[model samples]
Target chain A: MQIFFSPFSPYVRKCLVTAHELGLSDRVQLLPSNANPVTRDQDIIAKNPLGKVPTFITDDGVVLYDSRVICEYLNEMGNGSLLPSGGAARWDALTLQALADGILDGALLARYEDVARPEALRWPEWRAAQLDKAQTSLAHLQAHPALLAPGRVDIGTLTVACALWYLDLRFPDFGWRERFAAVAAWYESFSQRPSLQASWALPPA
Target chain B: MQIFFSPFSPYVRKCLVTAHELGLSDRVQLLPSNANPVTRDQDIIAKNPLGKVPTFITDDGVVLYDSRVICEYLNEMGNGSLLPSGGAARWDALTLQALADGILDGALLARYEDVARPEALRWPEWRAAQLDKAQTSLAHLQAHPALLAPGRVDIGTLTVACALWYLDLRFPDFGWRERFAAVAAWYESFSQRPSLQASWALPPA
Candidate 1:
């Protein structure tokens, strides 16, 4: 299978981390793509109408976009390690994953506004709103730190780590560490995992 | 199962429409909530940390957010009616759902910037960028009309219809009708369905 990915995307990192965790990294041939959201890539757009990263093409020639779906598909291929079997625990895990992905969405939008728009057109309030959403999500996750346990390393924890990593990358001044000490500590420890350590390497753009 | 939902949210509507179509609506009790993103309600936040609508609290009291997950659970309950069994068709259905959800996210962000942010903080360029994403998504869907055929109303077509309805509510000036005449007609026909009609009410303030 071939995975079309971008270096700087947290979504791609989530997929890579999941693949590594499932011991399926060797099965995926990662192909670099220049499909930035601000600048359209017609070829990538043709494959994925949304033109987003982490587009996985299965060996059977089926294309799948969206990191969450790709991760689920990969998990299915590897004995369903990342997702829980059923019931409340499964729902909580999936919901938590959605929350973390929501944080990434907010952070990405804020970054795009700052970089893609002219200085005069940049809206501080908009950026601040996105930051508020991210902070709110982080606070919730911190209050429930068990959600980040190693045994519970489902899609949610993986995504939460990536979201926090993105915040550190783009908004170092946000001071998330000061306020979200528990989450920060959790990430500090979790980032040491071999799957995370390997996937967390900064892509040289 | 109880579904906490806002009538106006396209995400909520998607879940409700799917439940009704799958004959699972009777199992879900709809609870109303005013959980605006800017002033997210504490109660809703307690139910869903992200404070998004269409949060499904299962019979076992597990809360599920993000329309995709909620719909999947509902489909599973009803013997996997909405989603395809499993194959390339299933991947296409899911990828299409993600694309439609992307359109809704962009449109909502554009609306939030105008309504939630103070007037002086509104950014026309950011709004334009979001509209461009939505338009591009619509154009792609328009070109592939087979994706929205009747009796084939999977998560993808349902979400695309919801996205079109949301655009009509928030961006009537985009003239999507004239440009994407086929999609406009498709949505018009789909919106007349009983399930769509039942879920078509506006969000309460």
Candidate 2:
């Protein structure tokens, strides 16, 4: 198994963390990628038209993409219980995953506005609105402590941890920990998981 | 079930279309929304935090957001086969859905660039790059005809149809029909499904 990878991509990290949790990280090799919104990468685009990182190739030569799809495939392949099989448990976990991904999406857009778009064309309101997604989401998680209960390990929790990881990495001064202390505390403990701590980079050519 | 809706949001349309396919459209009520990237909707944020259209509430009082999770929930509720149980079929359908969603994401970004951003803040290169995602994806579909094979009614094909629908609605002069004849030809027939043809709107107060 292989995944098109970018060291700083939160989506790529989600897949890697998922693999690590499922005990399949050793089997999945990292293939470097230059996925960008404006300056698209043709190499990754050849496999995934989106030209996004974390696109995966199975041992049987099947291609899979987008972090959500890749994570599910890894779960199934490893026979992991990261995703619930059915019922409300399934929906809850999936919805939590969606929320976390939404936060990352907002954060990424804000990051792009700051760095990718030219300064003269940057929109402050757009950037602030994008960051507001994270703010609102953190408040939601802070108020609902059960959503991030201790020792709860699933795609939902893992994804939330990944979102925080990205927040710390990119928006270090966003000060979420001050306003959403419960969520901050949850991340303090939850992010200590070995899977979340594990890092990936492409092997030497 | 109910969904926070915007008439022109393709993600919202994807869920409605999925519900329509599963014969659950009648059961799902549409709630009007002013979901915008710059001006976030507080009502949606109350439930979803993402402040995006297509936030859903089930009969059991469970809330779900983002089209992927809601569509899957509706599928399970209706016992529909839009998503496969497992295996290659499941991955293929999912990846296809991801591709189509990626196209929509790019298209939406481009749309926002055109209308949401101030004229002085617009970046032509960024908008073109966003639209290019659709172009490359269409070329990919044209090459892989089986991905859009006839008689396919799964989420993947349905989403591709939705993407095409949006392209026609928003970028009428894109000329995809002339450029990627195979994809255009496939969509011409596949989109005629009653599910795709159905339109949705908020219920009268």
Candidate 3:
């Protein structure tokens, strides 16, 4: 399989982490790629109209994307332990995945509001609004930090960890560790793992 | 199930449409709700830290949000026919659903760029950026109009229909039909269905 990838994308990292966990990392090759509103990479556009990375092309030539879906595909190919087989556990994992992904989305938008747009066109309220969603979500995770434990290092925990790592990369002064003690501790241990260490890159400013 | 909802949200409408299709509509009640940057609805926030609608409360007290997951849960409770059981059909439907949801996300952001932010802060480049995403996605759907057929009215088609309906409701002057005749035709026929009619609402100006 081949993947259009960026080292700094938290979503892409989530996919790579899933691959490592599934023992499929060596089976896939990374083709460094990037896509944005103004300059959509043709390679990504052909694979995913969203023009987003973490786009995967399976050995059989099946294309998949948007991290969550790609991760689920890999989980099935792997131990299938990342997601529960059935019932409430499945929903719990999936919902937590959604929450963490949501925080990442908001945080990315907030960054765009700050640095992507021209100074005169920047909207402080919009930026604040996006950050508020991330903060509220972080607080929720802090309140229930048990989700970050070893046994819970499924898609949800991995995603939450990735989101936190993104906060560190993009908004370091956000002071999440001071506010989310349990979350910070969980992330501290998890960041040292080989897959995360390999995937880490300071996202472009 | 009780769903914290807002009529204007296409995501919320997608959930209602799924309920109707699954014969689960009557079993769920809509508690009208809205949340955003300035005024986050506490009820929504309590259930979903993201504070986005289609926030759902199950009878057993489980909460789910972010449309796709809610739709899956409803599908499982219903005939289980909405999502293909397995294989290529499942991925096709899911990837299509993601694409349509991306269009809705872009359209909503473009609308916010116009009305949610102050006029002086409005960024035409950013607005164009978002609309371009929607347009690229719409062209993809147009090329695959067969996915929008009556026989294909699963989560993907429903989401695409809801997205097209949103463009109609919010950006009447956008004129998607002139460019995507097949998609427009599919949507025109699909829109009159009872499930869609029941879920339709005039979004706030």
Candidate 4:
């Protein structure tokens, strides 16, 4: 198995963390990629028209993409219980994953606004609105503490961990910890898992 | 079941279309929303912190969201076969959905640049690069004709159809039909399905 890798992409990190959790990280080789929104990468585009990182290739030569699909494929391959099979557990986990991904989506857009778009054309309201998604999401988690209960790890929590990882990486001074103490407390503990702590890099060419 | 509705959100449309396909549209109520990227909607933010359309509430009071999860939930609720159970078929269907969703993402970004953002703050290069995603994706589909095989109306094909629908609605002059005749031809035939043809609107209050 192989996955196109970009060290900073939260989506790529989500997949790698998922692979690590399932003990399939050793089987999934990382292929360096340059996936960008404005200066799109043709190399990655050749395999995934979206030109996004974390595009996966199975041992049977099948291609899969977008972190959600790749993570589920890894789960199935490893026979892991990261994703519940059915019922409310499945919906709740999937929805939590969506919320986390939504936070990352907003964070990435804000990051792009801050760095990718030219300064003269940047929109402050847009950037703030993007980060507001993370703010609102963290507030939601803080209010509904059961959603992030201690020691509960699954796609939902893992994806949230990845979202928080990106938040800290990009918005160092966003200060979510001060406002969402419960979420901060949950993350402080949950992020210690080996999978969340693990990092990946491309092998020497 | 109820879903937050935005007349023009392709994600919302995807869920409605999925419900229509499963003969569950009648059971799903549409709740009006003004979901926007810049001015977030508090009503939607109350249930879904992401403040996005297609946020769904199940009869059991469970909330589900983002089009992918809602579509899958609708499929399971209606016992539809939009998503395969497992195997390569599932991955392929999902990856195709991801590709179509990616196209929509780029298109939405371009749309926001055109209308949502102020003209003085717009970056032509940013908009062009966003649309380029759709161009490259169409080229990929044109190259791999089998991916959009005739009469195969799973989630993948349905999503690609929705992407095409959005392109026609928003970028009428995108000229995808002229550039990728095979994709255009396939869409012409496939879109005649009742699911794609059905139009959704909030019931008179």
The list of candidate 2 runs beyond 4 A from truth reads none
lDDT of 4 by residue, A129-162 (tens): 9999999999999999889987678999999999
Candidate structures ordered by lDDT, highest first: 4, 2, 3, 1
Question: On a 0 to 1 TM-score scale, where does candidate 3 land against the true structure?
Answer: 0.94
Clashing pairs in 4: none
Error of 1 at A56 (Å): 2.7
Reference-based lDDT, each prediction: 0.80, 0.92, 0.81, 0.93
Q: Candidate 1: what lDDT?
A: 0.80
Tens digit per residue, CA lDDT, model 2, A1-205:
9999899999999999999999999999888888888999999999998888879999998889899999999999999999999988888899999999999999999999999999999999999999999999999998898899888899999999999999999999999999999998888888888998887877799
- lDDT by residue (B1-205, candidate 1, tens digit) is 8887676788888998898888887778878788676666667778776666877888887778888889988988988657786666778888889888888887888898778766766667667766777878778877887777756678888888888888988888989999988887888888887777774443455
Give the distance in Å from residue B58's predicted Cα in candidate 3 to where it truly belongs.
0.9
State the TM-score of candidate 4 restricted to chain B: 0.98
How many residue pairs clash in all the candidates, one count each? 0, 0, 0, 0
User: After superposition, which runs of candidate 4 have C-alpha atoms over 4 Å from their true positions?
Assistant: none
Report the C-alpha lDDT of model 2 over B75-117, residue by residue, as the tens digit: 9988999999898899999999999999999999999998999
By lDDT, the better pick of 3 and 4 is: 4
